[model samples]
Target: MPPCTTPNTTELVMIMDVESILHMKEGLGETSYSQNSSLQKKSTEAMKHFIIDSALAAYAFKTPEIFTIADLGCSSGINSLYLAEEIIKAIHERSRQLERLAPEFLVFLNDLPTNDFNAMFLSFPEFNMKFKAGIELQGGSAPSVYLAGIPGSFYSRLFPGNSLDFIYSCYSLHWLSQVPLGLLDSDCKPINKGNMYISNTSPPAVSLAYFKQFQKDFSLFLKSRSVELHFEGRIVILMLGRRTEDHSDKCTTVLWELLDQSLEIMVSQEIIDEEKVDAYNVPFYAPSAKEIKDEVHREGSFVIDCIQAYELSTSTGDPKEDARIISMAIRAIQESMISHHFGEAIIDTLFQIYSGLLSEFMVKEEIKSSHLLVILRKSC
Candidate 1:
């Protein structure tokens, strides 16, 4: 386990698998997938308006003393720095509006056991120095904000009850530990070609499996949040999925195609056995709004503040621009593979195919997809 210091929680020893760490490292560096700078930037901006500000208001921690934020799946990168800055700005505005002094902030950035905590903390030094003016950041006499990395499952309690004021996770949670075993046949054969996992030709079983796991995890997620959050806590989750529900035929989107093409290249190169590829599925599931709402309602603890999905506006740019966003999505997949799943050897092959396929998709007809962002408040 890796060493982690959470001021208000027990020390969590890092227990990430060595293979998984290597996979995460390789995946993040891949050109098409981990390389999407635009998506990262857009996501950062959206988070400010929808999550940071919304969570603070819901928690009623508007005073400087009341500003504390946590990013649940905070993979090591510049995203943490962006989150820190947004939180600080929010705290400042709230302080001035209420005429209260700025308070100290304790930002807890958490991820799975294998994530890069050292890198996460390394991204914090600049933010730390930037906030050194001693302007009360959270509501304390001296405005100081401390950053720490915590590695653990999001479904487990990692903080004292009512300790956090805000929480956010992006492009995560779609992944499950492993595809449910039942999807395959008695002979242990995939009922359909890898479609049961998450492709254009997805099987109902695949969707059901993904939903069940999501519900189970989300149930645990809500319970974990309930235990750690005070009444009126706020949570923001950004999940990936298709925008339209009316399509009759099963078809893989450009994003999925890029990954598929990469996997194909690996098969051609004998990096992975053709049989192994067919037998395996990417432990992921993209859910619809209704599915998400049902799960949240079933948990029965939070009020759904808002839910919206639309085609990415930036994706409409020139051919090069559209290709860039697809590349970003691929990078996200790469990060997942290396950071969590541990598939280092296939990284190079994965990117080679991904870059080629994504460019092809850019020139195709219209592609519109939606991401669901939900803001939830714990109902007392």
Candidate 2:
């Protein structure tokens, strides 16, 4: 864990234990990530080609007896299973086409300790039966798929050196290990007051602080993966990103801005303290393509095989319905953090205000989040 400190104070403050608190809303309820994660599923579906291509290329490189692949930040949901199934099916098809025995797969699903692994695992029996039956119907033998769970942050080492053959993460890497340090001033006051993330109103230092944190976290991630990945192993990452170099792009920051407004409403109604809102900051960053390239170059571990950007329009053309969907999606991701900081009692009210605000905003403007897909090969 890294220490965060104020410039004027000699005392060092440790970042909060994010792994203990950060997780998607559990179970299959309406508010759970399993129900509200269609946005993530959409991103995964859109990037299926890159994922399959990378997987096949990796298999072709080394036909190992046991193909070990891990999905970092594999949140508990159908989408997680969907990704795993896609990779397994693709590899199975490739082996059949080549008329070679399919390698047994060692699939590791990883996430924070707080993730609901039980719920995810409960669905596995059905998933396995369906997958195997589909393969048999195609007149091919199903490759043995061994599933295991790894609970930890990807910023640290989770696997033995030279163990992983392929890695995939979707809509997860944008989250920093913790909130950036230096967001508070020398006086120990929040510098990014009233904003959960970088916005136009935020000072330049706020953006720099976020970028610095990202660089440190991302570099650590690359270094850890570089050690774990076998030679020429590949990693495919799909994450929230920005189209421009600017960190405060409206496309990336609008969601946060609306949430900030929702918080402001609660503060005005005396439901929560203004100071608490000021001190709270989201532990996430949407990096640009250039920032990723620079970090990979600085880390000197992986060669970028492909990097592409695409936009996902979050609007469904109905302001009210879109607001509801978007609000639930954001709430599914942020409820745990917000509840931890502000209390669980305010969860319903906060997102209600958020949904109303989003409704109005959508009526005036469309919302789109930029996503970056990058495939990297371990080098040196």
Candidate 3:
């Protein structure tokens, strides 16, 4: 997250063309996100109550006849509809209580341009059937659900002004728009060598660079979203985070450090290129709650309705079985980026190493994952 200059048209082409690399671009046959996404399922379920409650609060006012919603960073999977369905259920319940007609919903499922939109659109039939039945079961009037896939980076403009009533994002936002500049030396050699994210060995400049990038991308996110959302619209963002203010917290640190270790061993055995490892830095970060709140305040468009942090499990008791699933889940989201740099030839080997490393870490005592859930209401 280095200080990035405003890219010119041509530079922007290079800078913004990360869709080819930083996404879960796989289709449905194999290596799909849908197959490896149980962790995300747990993450979503953990946040369910907050999502439902937020919808209730936002709709307690005058519920619109044509309610518009967007799920930003909705990777190609049925999970994209999970929060949306919760919102729909809440709306139905409230409408039933008030003896009113439930409003029709227009949902925009957004992701990086390279995301598996085909898979998402393909799931619509089943989703629609469920949508119809769910409303009926709630004893409320059936509200039509319209689905559209918006392929673009949410860091920039997506929808028109005042177009969205609710915006929901989960397991995203931690992804920076692109890798930070200045991560490489003058010769384009890596500066933050041997680590994908901030590590204890990283220089202070590395963290500063990342911080600045998050600030810039998040500001753009707010500016665009503020314009797209109706007054009093609500958004809920759930992302992997850290409980402690320290950037060097161990809970968030172990995975990457172990990956670096595995890579180092591979380098010694000449199984992978050392220079490639040095040049690679992930476009992800686990920002502190203060970081999120500061950006929300600075953006000046949204009022914070609620902010809660939860500790999630990095273990599920079945260590050996959970290890493979968790590793594939990480690989599914990150394979594009890893393969682009490390080559697909080493992917299987690299993930095997990662899985072993992850298993070793998960079995340790009392590890808690820090997750932050923030709900915001667009100002009048």
TM per model?
0.81, 0.96, 0.92
User: Considering every candidate listed, which one attains the maximal TM-score?
Assistant: 2
What's every prediction's RMSD, in angstroms?
7.9, 2.8, 3.3
* lDDT string, candidate 3, 1-380, tens digits: 54344533322432455666688847764567887888888988978988888777667755888888899999977587888887887787777789888788888999987888887788889988877886678555677888888988889999999888888899889888887665654544566878878898898878888888888988999999999998888899999887777777777776678778878888988998787677677787888888989999998999999887788775768776667876788788888877777778888888888888777766765346678899999995
Candidate 1, 303-351: lDDT as tens digits: 8898776445445667666765565555654555432332656655566
The weakest ten consecutive residues by lDDT in model 3 span 5-14
Name the weakest run of 10 consecutive residues (lDDT summed) in model 2.
Answer: 6-15
**Global CA lDDT computed for model 2:** 0.90
Better of 1 and 2 by TM-score: 2
User: In model 1, what is the error at residue 76, expressed in angstroms?
Assistant: 1.4
Candidate achieving the largest lDDT: 2
Per residue, candidate 2 scores C-alpha lDDT tens digits across 324-349 of: 99999999999998988888999999
> Would you give me the overall lDDT of model 3?
0.80
Kindly report the root-mean-square deviation of model 1 from the true structure over all alpha carbons.
7.9
For the record, the alpha-carbon RMSD of candidate 2 to the native fold, in angstroms, is 2.8
